[model samples]
Target: MGTLNLSFQIQTLYMSPSSPSFNTFTISLTTNRKKSNCSRFSLSMGNPNDTHTKLVPGAAGFLLQDVPHFTDYLDHLPIVVHKESARGVHFRRAGPRQKVYFKSDDVNACIVTCGGLCPGLNTVIREIVCGLYHMYGVRKVLGIDGGYRGFYAKNTITLTPKFVDDIHKRGGTILGTSRGGHDSVKIVDRIQDRGINQVYIIGGDGTHKGAAVIFEEIRRRGLKVAVAGIPKTIDNDIPVIDKSFGFDTVVEEAQRAIKAAHVESESMGNGIGLVKLMGRYCGFIAMYATLASRDVDCCLIPESPFYLEGKGGLYEYIGKRLKQNGHMVIVIAEGAGQELLSKSLQSVDQQDASGNKLLQDVGLWISHKIKEHFAKKRMPINLKYIDPTYMIRAIPSIASDNVYCTLLAHGAVHGAMAGYTGFTVGPVNGRHAYIPFNRIIEKQNKVVITDRMWARLLSSTNQPSFLKPRDIAEAKKEKYPANGILDGKIVKTMSMN
Candidate 1:
């Protein structure tokens, strides 16, 4: 009995009975370089007795196999109900002693996808579901629809290994997710009723905050439920963890797109191709692709201002590149700045149940601005911008990273069963590892950006700095061409329209 279901939030259909419900969609997400359908899950109905070696990819074409299996640790993996778990007796004394027990048969766990879409969400979902059912002997893994809102909703789906069997390599999640809308009352009621023993959340910065809140609520309820969060998102903004899952895939795909775009841009001679990559608040996607595709002439990010006052910044840079360099390929983040911020801010007035405003589309606005800029400044300097937004976001072409997500998910299951609720299994220092829950639940992980990295990105024409990891700084500056005016003596000037 396969029970496969996707978690795509209801698209303005309002299927849930809740009022003023959060958009329960992507608009509330912090903008990032995005691509593909990015739709977001699956598992077997039951676990097989055979031990299989799942190969998950690490950075730079490395593969991690087997991973560590936690099924043998019966102490951590238990069959329980009502907070009581099944444990074998070791030795008993003649004197009377208190016997403690835990009730299992419960699933008060919450998992979510946050920030932006990443490949392998479905695989992660599968490992989680299978681990709970087969090893822990638990029942019912609730899939929260539309991210944080689903946790508070009249919306959720019951998951099993059978439910997620076919989605190992698919893009997005079977449980739909959103950025905010973590209402305590609604969430508390649901967990209390379902007897959820633990909660696991998957996301980056914006989404993880909600995880912290829900974890706190679990404690306040006097329930023994443990809370855990998995660090997801292509942006990889999460700190403390070695690397958030999905980032490598995003960077890899973005690099391919840039390579393809570069070949096309070079063929056109003197044309400027502006390819938008995924990092909205950050530049991981764009910058990494720029580093990968040295052929790219320029890169832009939200951190660095490319278009100053719309008249002379990015437009001037692109114009100069076309006239002098003969061709250019620029990588930019979707959440990038443009001359069109305030205008769009006035147009959209929708809010989530939490009363937060929706974010605007900076990618489209930037595309329009670039078209208008080149059209007005220089004579039809051929300009093109490829929005790999949904393309990379929803990509299911290959499963190198999906396998890794599954392994991590499997590791998470081991972690959870080890009474290790509240920790996200992740890579540590380039190795497979676990980031405990204390940082996410009990403390605030600071969002830090360094001075040197910022300076290099601003000055370099090659790559955006924010996308690179804090431990490394490899992005180089880009060089732009200055067109020379020819009347009598050749003089450099902004190319006239």
Candidate 2:
């Protein structure tokens, strides 16, 4: 991994101390950069100089003095690097700027949460409200009652420090949430009507798309509104960011369910405990929980496909595990084995209000299948199915997530105040950065079956990869279409039989 050394000059506009005029200065710096998909990494609002409207001249005194700020105009964090390209992708480092586009007292902001519920929602909401009030001295903040539709359909509530002081201790959002009521025109109209200069939207992929549209509409009308998104998903599927806000909390909470399943399976002879977790497109939750709880014998996820009734399929693995240990635990992500279920049940694909696919209950279906397979073999097995999808989501965030949510909320507030619109805030490479909405919403982050983490999970469970040579070939082609080369030795162990 060779580092690319680069040098560039950053032109910045700052207020002159001697005169009441903005002066431009150029600073050159040479540093090492990595290669990635840099094409879409730039913010959608275009150049920061063109996107911002000048604040009142004397309002510069309101800038926070104690807090550290990113004085450099070119401060950015590179996204994941790949060997294919030397051009590195980067996101603007998220924090307060020395000079802001909006005045403190003149700013009017609104916060809204859309899409499904997740842990740390209320915490993010609370931090955003409190960050504006205490950090920037912005007093007027309104909470959009529901999701996007609330912009025009529902009433707004005044949010203050006292109002959101203790909301972090609670689960869900105080502003409430919904799915798929996005009307960009109506939403922007309400923001303009209510004098909202800063709009904070919290949700998953769909909500961010809506925010991007709202930002576009606001920009088209030449409004000074800053639409910031805090990516929220229990599945940890949002890309560009290291992970979403509620992911650590969800992974922490999922352990409780896995522990119970382990206890149940260990209690009875030939007991099979099946646990289903939330992961619509990816199996991060299931993979992480299984790794955390070493009791799992097999972990099934959407990325790694598995088939039954074969020589070395899921049925054979389960039988072998039960015969060896007398009891076994299995964890399956909700989206895992969907193709198998559809093939067995001949079901049609359906979507929810937010355009997310409606997933069938994999736990129950797998449990039945295991029982049927064992019964035909004259084997008696007791199966207990557990689904903790909502339970984990409805709980308050853990200690680490609470702190993470605060950082995310504060990052969003700083970006919006600095006139960075159409961007979402999250940590890229362990540093918080403002990511464009298109970058995050363009593709989903999935558990890479060929990655070391997934390999570690498979090694821990002592389960077959359940992947054939064709699966390996497809994964390699999809991930590295340009080179047709995979970094790992996954293809060598593809013999499931």
Best by lDDT: 2
Off by over 4 Å in 2: 1-84, 480-497
Q: Over the stretch 354-416, how does candidate 2's per-residue lDDT look in tens digits?
A: 998888888888888899989999999888999989999998999999999999999999888
What C-alpha lDDT do the candidate models reach, one value each?
0.53, 0.76
Q: Write the per-residue lDDT of candidate 1 for residues 361-460, one digit (tens) a residue.
A: 6656776777776666656656666778777867652466666676677666655554433345565433444443434333322223344444444455
Clashes, model 2: 0
TM-scores for every predicted model: 0.62, 0.82
What C-alpha lDDT does candidate 1 achieve relative to the native structure?
0.53
